[model samples]
Target: MRAVRFHEHGGPDVLRVDEIDKPEISAHEILVEVAGAGVNPVDTYIREGATQPFTLPMIPGIDVGGTVAAVGDGVSGFDIGDPVYGTGIGKNHYGGYAEYVTVPDDRLVQLPEGVDPMVAGAAGVVSGTAWRALIDHGNLQAADTCLIHGGSGGVGHAAVQIAAASGANVITTAAPTYHDALTDLGADVVLDYGRSDLADAVRDAAGGGVDVILDHRLHEYLQFDADVANVGCRVLGIGENETGVGFERSSATRRKDLQLTMMTMFNTPDLRVPLRKLAYLMSEGDLEISIAETYGLEDAAKAQQHVIEESFLGKVVIVP
Candidate 1:
C-alpha cells in the first residue's frame, strides 16, 4: 500500500509518499481500503508537533471514507465491502492517508446511502464536531438564537446547517461572499465577520443577544462572544490560537454567567453515537458536506498546506 507519512514534524513539505505494507487489523479493528481522506487544520498541527505527543513517521489524516476490506473477528455489524466513514484514525495510529488503514470498529460508521465517498470522508470530523458543539455542548434549542463564527469554514458550515435544522434562529458570521450560500443553508442571519461592528450586528440580528454561540477562533472572538451572548448562554469553543495566547474573562462573561466548554472530537466517549446521527442527517439531506478541493494521495503535502494556509469554504479530501 502507498501511504503519505511524515518522519519528522515540520511544514507540509515533511509529508512524503512511500510504498508501505498495509496495516493489519486487531480484534476490535477493521481494515478499510481508503477511498477518500479529509485533511484538517489539526493534521497540520500534528505534523508540526504542536498538539499531543505523537510518534514519528505518522500518517496525518483524521477523517476517512472507505470500504471495509476486512473485518476483525470481534467486530460485529460490519462486513467486507461495506462503505464506512469516521475519524480518530491519524491521531494515535496509522491513519487514512494510505491505500489501506486499520480503524477501530466503533470509530467506523456505515456511510449512508447516496453519500459520496469524498463527502463522507470530509464530513466525519467537521460534522461530528459541529454536532457536538451546537447540539451537545451548546445545548441549542428551537427557540434559541445561535451565533456561529467562521460560518464559511468546514466546521462553521456544518454548525450553521445543524443549528438551522434544529429550528434555531441561526446567525452566522462569514465573508460577504458566503452570505447568500449560508442563508440558503439555513442561516437566518449572515453577518460579515470582517465588519467593524460585528458584535453590534450580532446583537441586532439576535434581538439583543444570542442564546448559544459556536466559536472556532476563541482568541479572536472570546470577548466578542461574551458581548453578544444572552444571559446564561452556552458557548462552545472548538479551536484556538496555536501560539498559546491567553484570554481574560470579561465582566459580561461573568455577569451573564456564560457556560464555556472547550471540546475536541477525540474527547468524545462514544464517537459512534454522534457519527450515526450525522450520517442520518446526511442521508436525509439535512446535512451537506462541501468539498473545497480533492487531491491525489501523492499530493498530501499540498493538501495539508491548503487546509491550513488557504481560506476555503469546506474540507480538502485526499483520494488514494
Candidate 2:
C-alpha cells in the first residue's frame, strides 16, 4: 500500500510518501480502505516532537472514514462492504493515514446515515470529547451557563452547539476575527481570548460566574478556573500542559472542588453510544462541522503546516 511515513520527526517536510506493507489484522479486527483521514492538533504535535515517546516512522492520523475492505475471523455485526468510521487510540498502534489500516472491531462505529465520509471522520474525536465534557462530566442543566475555551476551534464549536441545544447559555472565548462565526454556532457570548479581564465581560453579558467551563488550554487559565466557576460548579476541563503525565497541584484543585474532566474517548467501553448520538445531531442539523481547510493525501505536508501556522476554527481533513 502507498502511505506517508516519517522515519525522523522535525517538520512537515519529514513526511514522505512511499509504499509500505498493509497492516496485519488480528481475529477481532477489521481493515478499512481509507476514504478520508482527519488531521488534528495532536497530529502536528507528534510530528514536531512536542508530544512524544512515539515509535519512529509513525503515521500520525487518529480518525478515519472508509469502508470495510476485509474483516478478521471473529468479527461480527460488520460486513466487508459496510461503511465505517472510527478514531484509533494512537498510544502504540499505527493509525488511519494510509490506503489500508486495521482497527479493533469494538472501536469501529457504523457510519451514520445522511452523512458524508469526510464529516464522519472529522467529527469523531472532538465531538465525543465535547459531549463527554458537557453532558457527562459537567452535568449541565437547562438553566446553566457554560463557558467553553477555544470556542472557534474544533472541540469548542461542537461544545457550543451541544450545550446550547441542551438549553444552557454557552459563552465562549475566541479571537476577534471569529466572533461572528462562533455566534452562528450558538455561542451566546464570545469573549476575546487576548484579554485578561473576560470575567467582567462575562458578568456584564450574563448575570454571574458561569456554572461550568469546558477548557482546552489550561496552563494559562488554571488560576482562573475558580474565579469564574459558580460556587459548587463543575470545572470540567483538561489541563494538558501539566509538564508531565499526571496532573500536579492536587491541593489547589481539591480546594476549588473542581471536577476536572479527563476525557479519553478511545479507552472507554461505551463509545459507540455517544458516537451514534453525535451523528444523529449532525444529521438532524442540531450539530454543524467547520472545516478550517482541506488538502489531498499527498498534500499532507501543507495540511500539517496550516495547523502550525494558525489556530483554526475546526478540524482539517486529508482526502486520499
The local distance difference test score of each candidate is 0.87, 0.77
- Candidate 2 Cα errors over 4 Å, as ranges: 49-55, 239-256
Stretch of 10 with least lDDT, candidate 2: 244-253
Best by lDDT: 1
Worst 10 residues of 1 by lDDT: 243-252
TM-score of each: 0.97, 0.89
State the lDDT of candidate 1 residue by residue for 12-46, as single tens digits.
88889999888878899999988899988888888
Candidate 1, residue 150: the lDDT equals: 89
| TM-score quality measure for candidate 2 | 0.89
What is every candidate's alpha-carbon RMSD to the true fold? 1.4, 2.9
Where is model 1 more than 4 Å wrong at Cα?
A: 52-54, 242-249
